[model samples]
Target: MSKPISMSRRKWAAAWAVLCAAGLALTAALDASSARDQQPEKSVSAECDKYIADIETQLAKAKQEGTEDGVVALAGVHAGPENDDCSDAFRDRFGGDE
Candidate 1:
């Protein structure tokens, strides 16, 4: 037969169990909070379309001006380090300089 658990031992065991359950709940809550925070941007196509339109407008204005600055302007946008929503589509339509 097993030895009977003392009163103090039973109380300690119950406290330990409560602490473990609380820790697990805290971990799960933090995980869910992070997942919610990291939700992806929606309507990617709409954002990309607007970006492309702006780029094309700039390109058209440059073309109409008929100046050397037109080439510089186009090159500046093409060679930009930052990539926006339309970057891939723009790259596919017009080859990347690098």
Candidate 2:
């Protein structure tokens, strides 16, 4: 049979349990706070989607034309006012000049 745990050992075990519980609580609180602090993700707009499609078309045409300069220019196209609302989306999809 296993010997009964000593009083000092019981105290130490209790202290360790409390410390672990406190650490878990602290981690949970930090995770919750960080989630609240983060900005919400933006959804891509229809205008931006259309803008991207146009860019893709241009890129395809540039490839067909076999003009390296035209292809490069289209590759680095920036988002304009027509689709400014989804500038971030454009940047993510095609990378922006900025």
RMSD of each: 12.9, 8.1
- Per-residue lDDT over 1-98 for candidate 2, one digit per residue giving the tens place of the 0 to 100 score: 99996678889999999999999999999999999999887766775677678877777787788863564333434557655657777578768552
**Cα misplacement distance, residue 30 of candidate 2 (Å):** 0.7
Ten residues in sequence with the least summed lDDT for candidate 1: 72-81
Best by lDDT: 2
lDDT of 1: 0.66
Candidate 1 displacement at residue 6 in angstroms: 9.9
> What is the RMSD of candidate 1?
12.9
When summed lDDT is taken over every stretch of 10 residues in candidate 2, the lowest stretch is: 68-77
Query: In model 2, what lDDT does residue 39 have?
Result: 81
The residue pairs in collision within model 1 are none
- What tens digits encode model 1's per-residue C-alpha lDDT throughout 1-98? 99996678889999999999999999999999999999475333665566667767776777788742554233333333344545666666556642
Candidate 1: segments with Cα more than 4 A from true spot: 1-7, 42-78, 85-98
